[model samples]
Target: MEFEEVLNNLKLEKENNLAQECLNEIQNRQVLFHSGFEQEKKELTSLYRLRLKTAMDLNRDKFEEDVLANWKKTIDELESCSAKKLKLNWVRTEFKQFMIFWNSETKKLEGIFYLYPKNTIKDQEEYNTGIINGGLTVGSKKYNKGTFIKEWK
Candidate 1:
């Protein structure tokens, strides 16, 4: 099954379980008055909250992993499909189109790279330089000049 399907199933299961537990607790008056019940309720609530937070974290991590795995698989398929179309040791038009489609769907290359071919070597160099300058401009705008460098390192 696809990664998204797996994630959707997991999310649905979690929601259903939570709803059933909530209904059962309400039916039983699980937190109703009893000696030390308040304290026990508080502890259980905390534990539930912690477990929920952990589950959310795990879900996010799993989603990211799935996305990356699917992306890699897509790239591999594209490479195999384009193997016969390669020209001058560079990717062909079909591969370029595939990349564009992938990037558009993923938004993974936005504000990062522009992978188009230029008419000339000089234009290609200029494009690369422009991309680097643009990255620096964006970085400076979002943060203090050295902030990212320091934080990342």
Candidate 2:
């Protein structure tokens, strides 16, 4: 369903405080995910620059190997954590930082967009289609950004 519809339905469950809390927790997780994604982007950019400088000014093989090894260790940790479900309180306390670290390390290997491809046009199309199929919008006009025909009009 549309984000608005989803929120409306969620509000209806306000009578059940636990359900409301669960929804809040999920929303918080999404926020954490996005924040982590952005932080990772920055860290990857910095690491890329550092590695390039190190290779140019110092030892190429040694620098590259060290960075790669660090990256591999990060990937292993993320894989292990993802295999298990996290508790809500733990998620609240640690999710954003954990996600940032997870994202930063993953980006070091596969690139940032590899993890969250949502920024791509193809991904956007797929997501929009899913939203429509879920009865979230009546038509593309209701959700498509390009529907704004004005060029600063």
Q: Which candidate leads in TM-score?
A: 2
Clashing pairs in 1: none
How many collisions per candidate? 0, 1
So what's the TM-score on candidate 2?
A: 0.19
Could you give candidate 2's per-residue lDDT for residues 2-55 as a string of tens digits?
Answer: 233333444556664433543464454331112122333334445544754665
lDDT of each: 0.27, 0.34
Clashing pairs in 2: 2-136
Give per-model TM-scores. 0.17, 0.19
lDDT of 2 at 107: 24
Our tally of clashes for model 2 stands at: 1
Q: Model 1 residue 124 lDDT? A: 35
